[model samples]
Target: MKKMLYFFLLILVALGLAAGVGMWKVHRLADSPLLIRDETIFTLKPGTGRLALGEQLYNEKIINRPRVFQWLLKIEPGLSHFKAGTYRLTPDMSVRAMMTLLASGKEAQFPLRLVEGMRVSDWLEQLRAAPYIKHTLKDDSYRTLASALGLTGPEQVEGWFYPDTWLYTANTTDVALMKRAHQRMVKAVDAVWKDRMDNLPYKDQQQLVTMASIIEKETAVAGERDLVSSVFINRLRIGMRLQTDPTVIYGMGEHYRGNITRKDLETPTPYNTYVIDGLPPGAIAIPSPASLDAAAHPAKSNWLYFVADGKGGHTFSTNLNDHNKAVRSYIQVLKDKDAQ
Candidate 1:
């Protein structure tokens, strides 16, 4: 009986020792961080089983062993509740920490800046090169957004979206980003529209925006914006055509190539202020806040015409004959400079 009891005690000691060793190994494995070299993108497919996820991690070398990951999920089933989305995984993450991140489904984001005055085609090209953008902008999406914004006719989504830098995760949808950009623009327009000066010639905020957009395309010199605004306002008050060069350029369309030609001015298009009697059908480009402000409250001036001097500044004229002389002088100066 004594020998049997001793043997039983020895067996119990060995079993406890084995159990302790196993536990120690598991604890070490759990604490160890998996070393990864390159950046990896992990995607959790819809309804992917826990075992499959474990296997994927093992194959990608994100985890040392599949069984350990599987065991973790089995013990804590709640860890399998990770949402389906794209995640940027670092190689330096520990098995336990990685699992926790996967369950949270939070991903790193890259920011892209959309500057004002960019065309829709330019915007689309930018989004295509962006990381994790996944989907392309459909034709219908632009139409849908335009319709919602109360814009009609053949303009499409050209100048409607407001330009701003936005943060987006790799898993962000294209539609979501576009919608966000539109919302930002709408808010900006509304804020500026509310602060506009009363008794302006424009029928509403939209018309003001349209005029501001034209001024934005004409020049980037902030000091000259109010002056330019005055020129347009003066023309409007006198029932004269705007005759802005940017409008002619817009009318030329693909034929514009780069520089505006005399023929472009003579040609007639809806946007060609050289031929049209009033404001263009729509905005030529996206305007900045300062341009919008200048449009809202123009500097009270009688200037009706402006010609760019060889210098960065422009020479303003109060009458047509003065404008003609200034143009001639500017041309002569440019020629003399070129000859020299």
Candidate 2:
């Protein structure tokens, strides 16, 4: 009976050793990399319980087994408080690292690429259209929008907002987005003003904003802004009309179709650069930082004219003779292309 008791004790000891080894293997696996090689955008929805989340992790191939994760969650204290938000997750992350990331509550951000050179109306349309944004702009009118945003002094809402691919959280509001963009523009303009070149045609920062808007509309090419800015500055200095077609289009408001007309150019409005002696009463579009800088510190050039080169860019000239030659070449290029 003593020998039988010793045999049973040996069996129990062997079983205990086997169980310990098995548990050690499970712990190692919990710290190991997952099967997938790439990172992905993962969303942990609100009200997700541990079981559901473990299953989700398994389904996404983020973990080897849902049961193992579920078992771990049952033992982990204070880690049950997982955050609910979009996350950029990698399968290579260990189970422990994943849990820590989820628990920390830092969500991945999305971008709203408000392009450079869009008008206030275009910016407004984008603001209202974002699914993630909660819009509070009560009306589309300039007066209504200005009042709602607490913007003082200007009835017009043209170039106050900065253009950028603004990063945002899920709960970002449209009004908040606009306000931030406006503040950025203000800061940028002020910074540029302090470092402005000697004897710029702008009487104030707003005029510089107006000039920058013109420069933004004139060119999207990186190298062309300085030349275009110089031309406008020279024109402004010599009491020459800007004669830019964008001003005419802006003046037309909603009446502007796909194309401009001679009558449209002839018809005078506050934004018609051809009729207006200097910068318009306000900006026509949201200008970029580079364009703003270019306007504030125009290139030292005698260039007074530029025209579209019938390609993606413009042909700049220091004199009317060269400008007319460029214009004729541009027209001929268009005619030749049409014939082909």
Candidate 3:
């Protein structure tokens, strides 16, 4: 009887120890702090199984241990949940909380900013530089990609994309971004072109975009957009050459050395407004929405000439004499600044 009692006591003690270990594991999984001290993006890629994921989380220090999680994933009825996404995880969260968050599927996002008046090449460089975005353009050829975008104006891809802050996931590709920006531009143009001023000289919406791009490159001041648009409009209405420097520079292409040479203006390129009678063959740069709106509805003004004022704005003139005087004054201002 003594030996039996001793054996019974041993069994009871062993059972109690096992139960205690189980409770400790449950408590740790339920309330313990995560190994990561702050919020981080934990990407669970596609085809990541539960056991493999647990091991990865453990290796990444996202969790203190993976045994409890692995066991729960195997045994818990109606709790088998996992997803593939870039998850924003925090250290204050428990294992159960993390599991809940993963199940929720509210993935993290990234941002791409396309600024107005930027060159397409510069924009592509930015897309290539972003590490998070997937690169789909293996050829790195803008012309081929532009053709794929189904662009209409100029039969080229220079000023086709809308400028805005676009947010997306890590899976977003360069081609996808290009498609979205181009679509946005198309939508904006279609919406604004419907209510355009009557009897406009532009042949179609593409010509309007071309004009807007010129206006965008002309002025950095938002308030001056309409006035600048009017100057271009008046010039076009009277059969005068644009002679805008930006277009000449764009025509120079790789040869442009920060300034337009006399030969560059004299040599003919389709983009050279001086050489071309009307709007350039296509947009010189990407235009903003305000500029596009200004192109559709230019302010009522007969003023055809403008010269840069001493300030960061332009002085508009209707007559040749006044424009020459303004140009002289601008040159003098520059000389005075240089003499100083």
State each candidate's clash count.
0, 0, 0
Superposed Cα deviation of residue 47, candidate 1 (Å): 1.2
Off by over 4 Å in 2: 1-67, 74-81, 128-131, 138-145, 153-156, 317-322
lDDT of 2 by residue, 242-324 (tens): 99988888889999988998888889999998887998888888889999989978889998999999888999998889999
Q: Give Cα distance to truth, residue 327, candidate 2, Å.
A: 1.6
lDDT for 145 in candidate 1 is: 48
Model 3 spans with C-alpha error above 4 angstroms: 1-21, 37-39, 72-79, 91-94, 152-156, 336-340
- lDDT per residue as tens, model 1, 127-210: 877888856445434465465545564363555567778889876776678778767767877887788776677876667877
Question: What are the lDDT scores of the predictions, listed in order?
Answer: 0.77, 0.84, 0.85
The predictions' CA RMSDs to the true structure, in order, are 3.7, 3.6, 2.6
Sort by TM-score, best first.
3, 2, 1
What would the TM-scores of all predictions be? 0.80, 0.81, 0.89
Against the correct fold, how does model 3 do in TM-score?
0.89
Between which residue pairs do clashes occur in model 1? none
Error in Å for residue 114 of model 3: 0.9
**Residue 50 CA displacement from its true place in model 3, Å:** 2.0
Best by TM-score: 3
